[model samples]
Structure formats: structure tokens, C-alpha cells
Target chain A: MVNQQRFGLSLVALSCLVLTACDHNDNDEPAPMPPADVSYSYEVTVQNLTQGQPLSPVGVALHGDAVMWETGMPASEALEVLAEGGDNSDFIAVEGVLASATGAAPIGPGSSETVTVTVVNEPDTFISIATMLVNTNDAFAGITGHGLSELEVGQTMMMVLPVLDAGTEANSEAAGTIPGPADGGEGYNAERDDADLVSFHPGVVSADDGLMMSALTSAHRFDNPAVKLTITRTE
Target chain B: MKLKQLTSIMVATGLTALSGFSQAAELEITVQNLTRGIYFTPILITAHSPDQQLFNVGEAASTELQAMAEGGDISGLETAVDALSADTVANPAGGLLMPTAATTTTLSTMDGNTALSIVAMMLPTNDGFIGLNSWMIPEAPGTYTVYLNAYDAGTEANDEIRGGGAPGAPGLPVPPPLEDLVGNGGSGVTSEMTNATVHIHPGNLGDDEAAGGMSDISNTVQRWLNPVAMVTVTVSE
Candidate 1:
């Protein structure tokens, strides 16, 4: 009871000190000021949940309802560049993005990386995060147009994301086709040969499973809920 | 016609149609193919009691469930559910539900039917079907989404070849649309049954060969990951 009373008294004293400071400022005939612009910042942490596939540098953005990718729809050039290759340069340059950030390096299996995005004045209502599996043809995992506007400061949101096939490139899993540590070969190609629309990734069928030309083995096979992503509003 | 008949009978006998206090619910159900390449045969959707499971894992499938999973036919299963007084919507899509395609239907369930179940055989497989075994319908009105996995009924061998769809058949049923899509002239993948009970499918082992491989299914075209289907149910007030 004594500690509670003392804490209450200190709070009253602190308010009084602030009031005195405001009174001193009032003597200078201060003009009414408009509301200050606040910079909203969010930190997104992505953990790779695949066994052998390493995740590319996670690309994150805060934007409007304009989504990065849609299922059963052709992927935009920006998304193709990121999903086919491990490149996020074009994706971050997409228009209407309030703020964007990319991880420094690839996140391996069972590893995590945190990327921070900040926007000033604009309401960052939508959050989009995307990254490639790097071992497959065009498999990527992330969420797009996820609402974060209702998120308050210091609040965090968590979601387990499923893998999506970009459908820009065929999942041949051939030698010199994959871009990850397994193949260490080609990245993005302009040709749209496979299904031209994005959908859930029909997992990698390795060479062990009758895919003779597949550069991948059974070790590279992956399933749904490939990555665990957590978002937090820092400021 | 059956739903209308039930309504008319209740109207003619006008003495509180429900057996006791009403436990019925109106539902809007939507099923979508989440796979990139696969076709769902005529879907069998139903609302039944809590204890009436469609198919249970680690248990031998009922003959009615076996027929639906082996062939694309839901007649046997439909008849069995009718005997239980369950409300059902058979083949809402009218035909095959293609990859990424969705089908929606409304179900006005009877009293005591508080659980929902749906089953459909996926083409290109012998006894594999997408199964949602008796999910409890929520009392509150809201939208719910559930992902469904492919199950092997253990009634037939997963030969992955063209054959008749009768019960105890050795291969898959190829309808007219999938006639060209599925290849022919292949040796069987496996003739032995390791686990002779309803269980999670180990997925198809398709080969890159088009004509003369172990499995007629193309490795690049027919393989699927877990969660082959997505079901969204909206309980209306």
C-alpha cells in the first residue's frame, strides 16, 4: 500500500513539473501548432522452415491494397524477378510502396532474419512479404496485402505462410536451372513456359521419385507452411 | 427434389417438424482445388450427427466409402447417409472440379445433424480422395476455412494406370476429359499394399516418361503436395 501511494504521488509531481514547463512556454505567446508527422516503423522477422531449401533475402513492403501477387493470375515482372531469381531490387522499386526493406543475405534452413520498414505520414495499412526458396524453379513463400493498419505500437502478428509457385518458370529441377546452393546455376529467365498463373506449389518431385532429369533429390522436397513470419510495429 | 419433398411432408403434417428443439443450421459451403494439376470427381457433401464419421484414419473404409474413393461414384455413400437421415448435397460442381476451380452450395441441415463431411475422389489416383471427416458445425454464424488432405482408401492398389473404377479395381478411373491428359501403356507403380487401411496418402510417384514409365502419371504434371483441397463453410443465421 505504501509503495502504491508513493508511486501515485510521483506521478502527480511529474504532471505538475510538465504543467510548470508549459506555463513558462505560454508566457512567450506561443502560436497554435498543427499535429506533427509521425513515422511508423515495422519489423518483420521470417524464419525458414524448409529442410534443405534456403530462403532468399526476404523482401518486405508497406503499401495500399495493390497486392504483390495473386493466385491464378500472371505474376508481375517485379514478382517474377524476385521469385525466379533471388533479386528483390525491382520488387522494392514497385510504385505506391510507402516503405520497403530487404534482408542482407539468404536465410538458410532453420534460420531467421529481421527486416525493418518505415514510412512517414502515410498510413501503412497493407504489409507484403515475399522470398524465394532458391532451390526450386519459381517457388516462393510470403503474405501479401495483409492488414496491419489496425496494429498498434509494440503489437506483433504471427502467421505461418504456405509456398506458392510463381508459374513464371517451369519446375524442371534440371541441372543448371536452380539458383540455390544445391545447383548454384541460373536464376531468372524471361520465358514463361510452365503454367502462366500462380498457384500453390506442387512440391518438388526429386530425381529419386522418377524425375530423371531433376537436379533436386528427395532432400529438396518441401510442403506447405514453408516459412514462419512475425510482424511487429516498432514505432 | 428430395429437399422439396421433405419440406412438403413437414407442411402437410404441420405439427412442429423438428423431432425436438431445433438444432439445424443453414450453411453456405465452398470447396476449392488448391492443387496445380488435379481434378476432383463429383463431390459428396453432407451434414450428419457428431458420431457419424465419413472415414476414419487407421480404420478400414466402409464399402460405401470404398466405392466413392475407388470410383468417382457417390451413389453408395449417398444412400448410406440417407438412411441416417442426414442432409446432403451431391455433386455441387455437376462435374469435375478442375485445378484452382471452386464450387459453392447451400445446405439446410436437419435437426441433430450438427457435423459436416465432404469427400471426393481425385482423378489420376486409384483410391486417393480428399476427405473431411465429420467437422463439428459451429453454432455461431461466421465463415470458416479448412484445408483437406488426400487419403488412400486401401480398397484398391495405387497402380496409377488406366483401368475400370469398380470396387477392388486395380487402377484409376479416367473420365472423358482426363482421357488425353492421362497417359497409357505403363507398368504399375506398386501392386502390394503396405498399410491396408485408410491413411494419409504418400503421394503419387509419377515418372517423367509419357508412355512407358512405371507410373502413367507424369512426374512434371501430376504430382501434388499435402492439402490438395480447401473448404470454406459459412454458417448463416
Candidate 2:
């Protein structure tokens, strides 16, 4: 708490120094006072809880109250691409996103990643996070349209998230389908083969467990509560 | 040791009620089986003292728990909790809770019963069950959602073959509906109980064949991800 106060004081001091420097250099016409911009910063940390499935790069977004996805509803094209291929490029750029951040690389099982996002002058901010379980056909884990407006600075929120099947692609476990290292196959395909609506993932049926065409093995099996997500308001 | 905590909670409740500060809570609970192929036998939802746990992870399963986890029997558990004057609703869904099905029941808990626990056996596996053990009821009246994972009772082996439903049974109990879905005999999955204490279940290893696989359970149909159950609790004002 003391450190935060000290940091705020130093920022004020630095701004004062900048204003003084401008006054001395441009005495003829003083620089116009910049608009007061208050920044809200959030640090989002995601931990992979699965035994084998590696999480794709985490995508964090600050947006309005619109839900990114819902149960029984078809996944957006951005979500479908990310859930199928573990490519979150379009997901982080979805409409209505005010600010976003993406993890540098895939988070291995039992690993965690932290991404910090900052938005200026956006007080009523809502957070959404999305990431794919790279070993599955189109399985993803995330929370959509969670309100963060009431989260006071320095407060922390934690949640254990459940996995969701994007339903855009079939959980075939077939060769040349999964994009994880276990398969080294293709990622997102535009075709909607399976149930197109999002729902809770039923889990992987690996080849060791009787799926004859599956490229996955028993090690790829996982249960619910696949990720532990933590959010902290830094500023 | 845990029993002492329960006594203290009871005493505190007595004092609060005598001081004219009764905190009776009314709760409406729903349990949904989210698995794709697993079936839940007779669910047991109870609201007891804070320290009274229906089941604890990493601990030994009680005899009552063994009976319920092995077979679809809840009479022993019901009797045990009834002795504590707990608020319980056993088998809200008449019988088996099929895949993707749900059961709802309302419980008006007396003062001091502020913890909730729910348990049910998952069929097609030996001693695999879903559990929510002693979650403290929030003081604020609001709706809360909790997801549950599959647990092993640690009393029986997970040999996925059709066998008796009795405690210490050798194989899985193939109910009438599951008889056709479950396969015939080859050999048992395994006769070993690696973890004698309750733990997270290492899911079933089903095979493709029906009449002549290593086990009877179907691999393609019975597999599930974590969070086999979702419990929604609504605390009323």
C-alpha cells in the first residue's frame, strides 16, 4: 500500500517536472495542458490446471457488457478460430474491445502466464479471457463479460474456470486435426462439423481409451475446472 | 478434533438464538449431471454443521460412503446424518440421474446448519462418485454455482466389468438400462487399489470392443472431462 502511494506521488512529481520543462523551453506560447487521462490497469494471471493439455496464448480484453460467448449459442468467428487452432489473433481484436493483451507463448500444463492490460479513462470496464486447450479439437476455457467496474484498486479476484467446447468442430481426435504437439496437425478449419453451439466439454476420448482413429492417448484426458484465473487491479 | 469444532458452532448458535438473533437459512439447491455418458445413482444433499463433512478428500471413506459409492445405496448415509439432525434431501431425482439431467430440491435449514454437501455415485465405474464436501453457506443471500469433480472412494478397484453392487464388490454394477450399453466380459480392468485413501479419480480406460475387450465400459461413450456435476445453490432472503 505504501509503495502504491509512493508510486502515485512520483508520477505526479514527474508530470510537474515535464510541465516546468515545457514552460522554460516554450515561454512565447506555453504548451496546452494535456487532457487529464486516468489509466486503469489490470494484471490477469492464468494457470493451466490440466495434466497434459497445453493452453494457447492467453487473450485478455476489456470491453462493454456484451457477452463474448454463451452456452447454447454459436461461437463467433473470432472465437471459433481461436478455439480450433489456438490462434488468438482475431480473438484479441474482436469488436468492442477497448484494450487487449496476449501471452507471448503457449502455457504448458501446470504453468501460468500473466498479462497486464491498461486502458485510459475507461472506468466501467468489463473483462473477458479466452484460451484454447491445444490438444482438443475445439475445446476452450474462459470467462465472458464479467463485470470489473466494482473491483477496487489493489483488490484481487480469483476463479477456477471450466472448459467449454466451441462446438464449431467435431471432437474427432482424428489424425491431422488437433494442433497440439501430441498431434502436430492442423488447427482451425472453417467448416462447422459438430454441434455449432457452445457447451461444456465432455472430455477427450483418446486412442488408448478406445477411439480407433484418435491421435491422442490416455495422457491427453482431462477433467473440469481446467484453469485457475486470477485478476488484480494494479491501478 | 473436527467434532470439537462442531460442538463450539452448536453452542454459538444456541447463544445467538437465545439472544433473539436467529439465522435460519432457506436454500434451494439444484444438482445437474454434466457428463456425457455417466449416470448418477441416488443423490444425497445435506446441510449440516460447518465441521461435519460428508466426505473429505485424502481421507478414508466411511462405511456409509463405501456403500453409497460402490452401490446406489444412500440409506446408511441418510441414517448417519439424520442422527445429527441435519437438513437433508436424498434422491431428489426419483432414481438414476441420467447424463445431462438435473434434480432440484428446497431445504429449510435450522440455525447452525450452515454447510452444504452433496454426493452421488457415477455408474459404469467401480466406486467413482461426484462430491461437494462441506461448502460453507454464504451469509449473503445470493445464487452461487459450484462445479464438482469425480472422486474415487478408494474402497474398490475400478475394474470396468459387470459385477455385484455390494460393498467390497469386485466389479461395476451394470444396472438394467446400462446392461445393453455396457459390453460383455473379457477380463477386469485391474484388481489393484493403488490409492486406499479417497482421491481424484483417474478416469476409466475403456476399450472399443463390446463382447471381447479388456473391460465392459465403452471408451468412446463414457469418457468425461473434469467437473462432472454442477451444483447451483440459491440462498433466500
The C-alpha TM-scores of every prediction are 0.87, 0.75
Worst lDDT 10-window in candidate 1 chain B: B13-22
Q: Please provide, for model 1 over B1-237, each residue's C-alpha lDDT reduced to its tens digit, 9 standing for 90 to 100.
A: 999999988876754543343488999999998777888999999999777888999999999989899888899999999999999999999999988788999999988898899999998899999999999888889999999999999888788888989998788888999988888888988888888899999888888877888888877767888788889999998
Candidate 1 per-residue lDDT over residues A77-114, each given as its tens digit = 88998998989888887998878999999999999999
lDDT of 1 at A118: 91
State model 2's lDDT: 0.89
**Chain B TM, cand. 2:** 0.91
- What TM-score does chain A of each model score against the native chain A? 0.90, 0.86
Most DockQ-accurate candidate: 1
- Give the per-residue lDDT digits (tens) of candidate 2, residues B162-188: 898899878888889887888987598
Which residue pairs of candidate 1 clash?
A: none
Candidate 2 structure quality by residue, lDDT tens digits, A1-235: 9999999999999999999887666367767998899999999999999999999999999999888987656899999999999998898899899999999999999999999999999999888899999998999999989999999999999999888889889788889999999999999899998767776787888888678889999899887689999999999
> TM-score of chain B only, all predictions?
0.90, 0.91
* Superposed model 1: Cα runs more than 4 Å off: A1-30, A122-124, B1-23
- Give me the runs in candidate 2 sitting further than 4 Å from their true place: A1-54, A70-78, A89-122, A153-163, A167-170, A189-212, A217-235, B1-22, B34-36, B50-53, B56-64, B79-84, B94-102, B164-170, B175-181, B194-199
